[model samples]
Target: MFVRIVKMSFEPSNIDTFLKNFEIKKNDIRNFEGCRFLELYRDKNTTNIFFTYSYWDTEEALDAYRHSDLFKGIWAQTKPLFNDKPQAWSVDKLESLT
Candidate 1:
């Protein structure tokens, strides 16, 4: 499994709008092929900071989703809300306790 995390910092006034957009499209993104899991988290100390945690079957699967029309539509709406360039990383588990 591939684990992906994306950290985003949004403009203060855009936080609510960003959450609304994310909520509207979250299900469709989670249901995409090879998507195993999806979730969003907000920073307790920073209201405009958020993170997205997701799992995919493989890097190729995630790439395919990134290139899809759904991604384009969602991203177009999402990009303008950013206060900073987003950070993203992918990992494969080597060990787990649970």
Candidate 2:
């Protein structure tokens, strides 16, 4: 499996709006085909920063989701709320302790 991690920095005032939208769309994202898992993490010291950790079956699966309407809608709502450009990483899982 592969993991996708996205780091997002949001405008302080837009955090709540982003969270609400994420809550509404989380289920759909987790249930998307080839999505093995999904998680969201907020930086402990930086309230405006967040990360999305997700597992996918393959790179093609991820690309499919990226091109879907669901992603488009979600991005449209999300992109405008960011204070800085989002950063993402796609990597193969090398180990898991648990």
Number of the predicted model whose lDDT against the real structure is largest: 2
Q: Which prediction has the highest TM-score against the true structure? A: 2
- 1-95: candidate 2 lDDT, tens digit per residue: 89999999999999999999999999999999999999999999999999999999989999999999999999999999999999999989999
Once fitted onto the true fold, the runs of candidate 1 whose alpha carbons sit more than 4 angstroms away are: none
Each model's C-alpha lDDT?
0.95, 0.98
Cα lDDT of model 1 by residue, 1-98, tens digit: 98999999999999989989999999999999999999999999997899999999999999999999999999999999998999999988778796
> Looking at candidate 1, what is the lDDT of residue 54?
97
Q: What is the Å distance of residue 94 in model 1 from its true position?
A: 2.6
lDDT of 2: 0.98
RMSD of each: 0.9, 0.5
Candidate 1 lDDT score at position 5: 96
Clashing pairs in 1: none
